[model samples]
Target: MELLDQYSLSWIIGLVVALSVTGVIAGLMAGLLGVGGGIVIVPVLYHLFTLLGIDESVKMHVAVGTSLATIIPTSLRSARAHANKGNLDSALLKSLAPSLLFGVLVGTLISGLVSGLVLSLVFGVIGLLVAANMAISKEPAALAETLPTGIVRHSIGTGIGGFSTLMGIGGGTLSVPVLTRCQVPMHRAVGTAAAIGIFISVPGALGFLINGWGVPERPPFSLGYVNLIGFALIVPMTLWTAPIGARIAHAINAGLLRQLFAVFLFITAVRMLYGVWA
Candidate 1:
């Protein structure tokens, strides 16, 4: 019994260490790339949950939910840093808010009905496409000279929100590319997307909280699908590093940033896909 207790204690320590490291990386990614760190957080949490012997049926749900919750603070800090640097587009942010919220609601509802495998598939496929685009086209041509208005803009915002929620992202991965395609500069797009993450994460997290309220086999200290322990473990490190990341984003070359982001995401996506198939 003593040996078993030691083994369990060791596992707990290792998990905590891993989560701390994940938080650091996630914070950097959120600030540097406007990704809200959800892309990094979700996968790491999923793997950790698996190691913890969480039930397979709800593993992805918890990961996604917890990721959205963590993003709230990281995105807030990242956006504030970018705003201080005059990188954010306040007008664009205002226009997209309503539709983004709407889409998050739609996504949360969908999440409740899907299997963990399906969510993993969505994450892998989208991650690959986003990575490929970033890798191949550092400076994509503009599709329009200015941002769209009315129904067109709303539709795009809705899609970004829905997809991001499904993937446990902050909408930066999709929004940055779309903004750039509309003739927005890379840095501005990135900053704007960081703000956009706020629109997605708050409502998305709440939705997950309500959606998973009574689910079985959740990790200890979970409030619905969001694991409080993971949130607590990850938030502090991300809070500490996120501002630093935002500063680095402004200093770096835009093209190099895209390439680096692409490489990291490509590896992550490939690994996620392999997990799905394996």
Candidate 2:
């Protein structure tokens, strides 16, 4: 048990403040970096749950599920902003939708069976990889002149959705890399990936809701694994800030921003991994 388990007024105030900061940063990353903010949100939620004395068996599940739920609104706001800026790749998004949904379903099912330790490991490993890539690569050269199709498309789309669901992220974290590899410009890659997040998040969030139903040891005000209070507090802030990130993404160079974010991810990833071994 932790100090916050008592849920005193001071604890409540502290929680709100923490959640508010999380939402603001998550939203900014969603719009500015094309990630659904799951990368940021999941670890934050995990630590918060730990502080609240949430059972280790279900804390990671709750974190992932709740992160997915939050991505829905953030993705929508970010995607729309990207569209307005003429950065979205609609054709590619349409082609990938079905597979993404299928993957989310599959991932959600798997999450129900996996232990919290395993989930933490997965998040940590993926976060480390993503952070390293961002920190090391100044420019990702195009490997192909066009988007993937047929089996490749199916594999990539499904993988993006499944992996993202498992990690509690929107598709952007993976899809942006894939798109850039396919020769999509940075702006369009980010924009299109933002749209792809919608496909992954909507279905992923619902799948988590159903998957977590009747599960034991969930935090208070939880509907399945999604904490209603966290959802409520985070959503409004994310929605308000996402578009601002989008505007900034379109207006300026993001290389420095990516570098700074990579550093943050690296630290977060290490902490997550350490928690697993500890």
Best by lDDT: 1
Considering summed lDDT, which 10 consecutive residues are worst modelled in model 2?
A: 1-10
- In candidate 1 the C-alpha lDDT for residue 18 amounts to 74
RMSD of each: 3.4, 3.2
Candidate 1 accuracy as TM-score: 0.86
lDDT of candidate 1 over 1-278, digit per residue (tens): 75345347676677678778878887787668656578878877887877778788999999999999998887897789889999999999999999999999899999989988878888989989988887785357789998899999999989999999999999988998899889898888988998999999999999899989989877666899998878898999888877788899999885678689888778877877887789
Best by TM-score: 2
Please, what are the lDDT tens digits per residue for candidate 2 over residues 1-278? 45357557776777778778878877888678756678889988888878868899889988898888988887787789889999998988888888898888889888888898888888889999999888875576777898778998999888998999999998888888888889888899888888888888888888878878999788766788887777888888888887899899988878778888889888888888998899
- Model 2 residue runs over 4 Å out of place are 1-9, 29-34, 243-257
